[model samples]
Target: MAKKVIETSKAVAIAAKLCRPSVIAAYPITPQTHIVERIADFVYDRDMDSEFLDVESEHSALSACLGAQAAGARTFTATASQGLALMHEILFVTSGMRLPVVMAIVNRALSAPINIWGDHSDSIASRDSGWMQFYVESAQEALDRIIMAYRIAENKDILLPAMVCLDGFTLSHVFEPVDIPEQKEVDKFLPSYSPLYRLDPKKPISMGPIGFPNSFMEFKYQQQEAMQKSISLIKKTHEEFSNIFNRSYGNGLIEEFMTKDADYAVMAMGTITATARHVVEELRKKGKKVGLIKVKTFRPFPEEDIIKAASKLKAIAVLDRDISFGQHGALFSDIRSALQNKDIIINNFIVGLGGRDVTSDHIKTAFDKTIKAKQTITEWLF
Candidate 1:
């Protein structure tokens, strides 16, 4: 293993390279372009041997990956904001078809005014698309999750697509010292893609055909079953990866920091969790009973883990980077559902929309409000 101070995009590209995907198709999008560019470097230098497709659009990129993965090849792709929105239709197709395609989402805000900056709107908007969503807080987690996404998604019981999301510009453009696992170690952890089923001419089987009314609901039911099954598979895969790599993130779902004895806590995902962690520490030093909950996996919701983490706390603040429009924050809604029957106060704070910086002061304010909140409070922290 080697540790290097490199851009988060570079770390993602290198991690994808180490996994040795046979096919890569991605369109250039702001912030996300760097990841594909670095992978192109690997293909150009012959450091990585893969079929790097120069696709025309984000839709085409994921389409190409879907075809490749369906034909028994491990595939990868990436995008952000509009690029992800463009691939919306295919996103459902890829997941519903049960292709284990992996994607990196440099999370960014969707357009109305055409702004391009960091936010969870892109991925959060696709929450119901049947893809296993993994959110990371740093370059290192981004690197590791890409490798783990493969094993978890490609599991025999869970042949579903997965996307690893990281905040754009915030974490993607920043440079940090990350430990890159050796290729052999990664290979040992993640063996080459041996799909149980494939689009082989010899087999000549049909897949993803139109589901009739008789079977449409059944197909949807199966997808839900696999999603539920994946919760355990994700945890197991995380444990196996940590055993070999000696690194982990709170059991590969939700990480609770300093929440053991705290009376109140802050809950959030992505890079903002880092700032929240700092604020929690500062509040701790001041003898405030506060903690932080960092969510690593968004999809499959981690409801039980969330409930367990929020238990015993007097009140909890849920910070979200995306709003559901006319409703509370996207994540806050989920948090409320998880703790709906509990006796604790749950407050929602929507911050960092459309790339606005989420400073520590903003996080401190969420904690301060949460600790003293008497009932459910929703506030915009812009």
Candidate 2:
């Protein structure tokens, strides 16, 4: 296996090649441009047997993907902030149809005033649209999660769309060394996709049609069951991926560092966890008991796992890069819910909004505050 320094765009392209999508419907946007561009180049060069549908807008891109997936073709697409907002309506439709479409969302700040920098607002806004969302902290995680997402989403028990997110310029444009597996290995890991139900003229079936009140609830109930069932499928996929790649993602719910005997823990998502881990190491060296928890999956919320990890600690600090507005951070509310009825002290800190820098010192500051507060606080605004 050879290693090469590659940009996030190339890494994603390589991953797509591994997944072997049959159809790619995408429109170009800044920060997200290279990913689709590289894939298009791959298609142009006949390196992969796939259709690259160049649509006029994000709406059309998703719409095309929906049709392709409905026709029993493995589908993929890429988008950013404004583009994602444009596809908001179709996003719900994809989930409602239960089409296992895998998309790469280069996390970007949404606009009242147009901006292209990274933020979670774009994807978080559509959290309720029935899509399984996974936030990646690095280029490697982004690549790995895409492969895992396809397997998870297409599982017979969980036929739902999935969004794999990476920060706009931070991980997307930054160059890093990545290990890309061989095509044969990827093929062995991810075989050709076979949809349970698809639109076919020979055996036609209607999809995404309006259901009356009589059966609407049943459809929704099944969707919920599928989502609930995804938890186990997610775990199974991680195990299989570990067996093939020789690297384990550690349960696919949360990754904990030095939490076994720690009294204080910091919780975060995406790349910010990397900084938190460094601060935790420093605190440990100073004889302070501290740990870090990185949340990889956000949609399912992983309530039980969160409770199990944070319950034993005296104090837990949640650092959210995203804001829910009028409430605490998004993860803050969920952590509180997970700790309900349990005797545990939790603090919520909202930082790194609009792509602000969240340094190790900031994490250390939060940890110090948590230790000093010592169960006398509920939430601290950082």
Candidate 3:
């Protein structure tokens, strides 16, 4: 692998080329538009070889990917926010059919208030869509996740579609130094995808067929089993990746920063966690026992690690970019529920919605309040 400074979107395009997907269907929206644009340039310039289709809509993009994957081919697609919402219906079918299609979703806040900025709302809202999710911190992480995602999703034991989400603009538009793996090395890391079953005329099989009341619940249970089973496989895949490429993130589940010996900790997802890390260091120097835990894999939820981390801390501040109206922040709710029996205060802070800048000061304030907080509740941070 060679290190190169490139824009995040361009890095994704480079990753696509290395993975050698058989088919890539795309319908681009804000932030993610550059991702498909770079792919188009690669296919147009003939630097990469793949069937890149500019489908009319996001739903069509995912639908086309399903067809390709079901036909026994490695497939990929990308979208964000509204575009992802558009394809919401077909997302379940993709996973329900057990197609290992990988997608790059530039996480952006959903609308009603009309936002085109980075937020977890876009992906968090689709948490139950049955797709394994990864929230990356930087462009380099984005590129790495893409390569690793294929291996995890296409594994025989876990045949579920996976999504690699980078914050809209924050991680997408910003440039970062990424170590680009060579084609041969990537090929060695990820073997050619082999499907258990295919849409071959010789062997006709009914897939995603109607399940009777008794049988329908079984299908859902299988999906749940695959997701839960993926926990270890994901860890193993990340370990393998580290062995081959010398890169790994948070044991393939959760990444902890300065949380080993601390009385209070902060938990957050996406790019904001980076800022919180810095704030933790500053608080450490001031004699405060502050730590950070960044949720890297969200769909499987990493419940075990989170519970263990919160067990030692007196309190935790769950900084979320997305809010669940009437309830609490999505991340906060999941974490609170996991730590329900624990005797610790967990404060949910909704910050940086609609592209707001989540600076060090905002994170510092959250930490200050969290370590001193007495009650468990959700609060909006401005």
Candidate 4:
């Protein structure tokens, strides 16, 4: 293993390189472009041997990965806000075909106003796109999760695509000291892409065929069943990875920080979780019972783990960087669904949308409001 200070984007690129994907296809977009660029360097310098496709757009990028992955090759791609939005339809296609293609998402704000700053809106908007989403707070976690994502996504029980999300510019552009494990160790942890099935000329199998009404429901049902089964697979893979690499991210799901005995907790994803962690520490120093819950895995929602973590808390302040138009924040809605019929007060605090900075002060206010709230509340932290 070697430690080097590097940008999260480079860390992600190195991680993808270590995995030795057979095909790399991605179009350039801000924040996320660096990741693809670094990977291209690896391919061009012969440090990595892969079929690097210079795709025309984000849609082709994902579509190329889908084809490569279906053909029994390990595939990868990366994109930001509008790029991810463009790949929306194929996102379902990749997942529906049960191809285990992994993509790194540098989360940026969606268009309309056209902001390129960091936020969770991009990935959050794709929540139902059938990809397993893992958000990271730091470059190290970004590198580590990319490796782990491959293991989880390729698992026989969970042959689904995975998205490793890091805040654009926040984590993506920032530099940090990251310990990159040797490729040999990574190989041991992640053997290879032994696909359950592949498009072989010898076999001549029909793939992605039209699902008639009767077959269509079954196909989707199977996807849901696999998704539910992934919950345990994710935990097991996380444990195995931690044991092997001596690094982990809270059972590969919801990471609780000082929440066991707290009266109130701030639940958040991405870099904001880091901000909340510090605020939680400061609040504790001031004798306040505020803690933090860092959600590492957003998809397959970690509902049971979240419920268990919130059980002892009096209230929870769910800080969502993305808000559903004319409704509650996506994370808030899911948190409420998980804790339904419970007595604990859950407040939804919408913050950091369109790349607005979520400072420690914002987190502190959310915590204070959560503790003082008599009932569930929804407010924007502007």
lDDT of 2 by residue, 217-300 (tens): 998899888988887788788889988887666688788899999998998888888788888888899999999888888886
Give the per-residue lDDT digits (tens) of candidate 1, residues 151-236.
Answer: 99999899999999999999999999999998999999899999988898888988789999999999999999999999999899
Model 2 TM-score is: 0.96
Ten contiguous residues with the weakest lDDT in model 3: 370-379
Off by over 4 Å in 1: none
Clash count per candidate: 0, 0, 0, 0
Deviation of model 3 at 13, angstroms: 1.5
Name the top lDDT candidate: 1
Q: Which lDDT value does model 3 have at 67? A: 92
Give the residue spans of candidate 4 off by over 4 A. none
Poorest stretch of ten by lDDT in candidate 1: 364-373
TM-score ranking, high to low: 1, 4, 3, 2
Candidate 2: worst-modelled 10 consecutive residues by lDDT: 373-382
Tens-place lDDT digits, model 3, residues 118-155: 88899988999999999999888899899999999999
Compute each candidate's TM-score over C-alphas.
0.99, 0.96, 0.98, 0.99
Q: Tell me the TM-score of model 1.
A: 0.99
- Error (Å) of candidate 1 at residue 44 is 1.1
Clashing pairs in 3: none
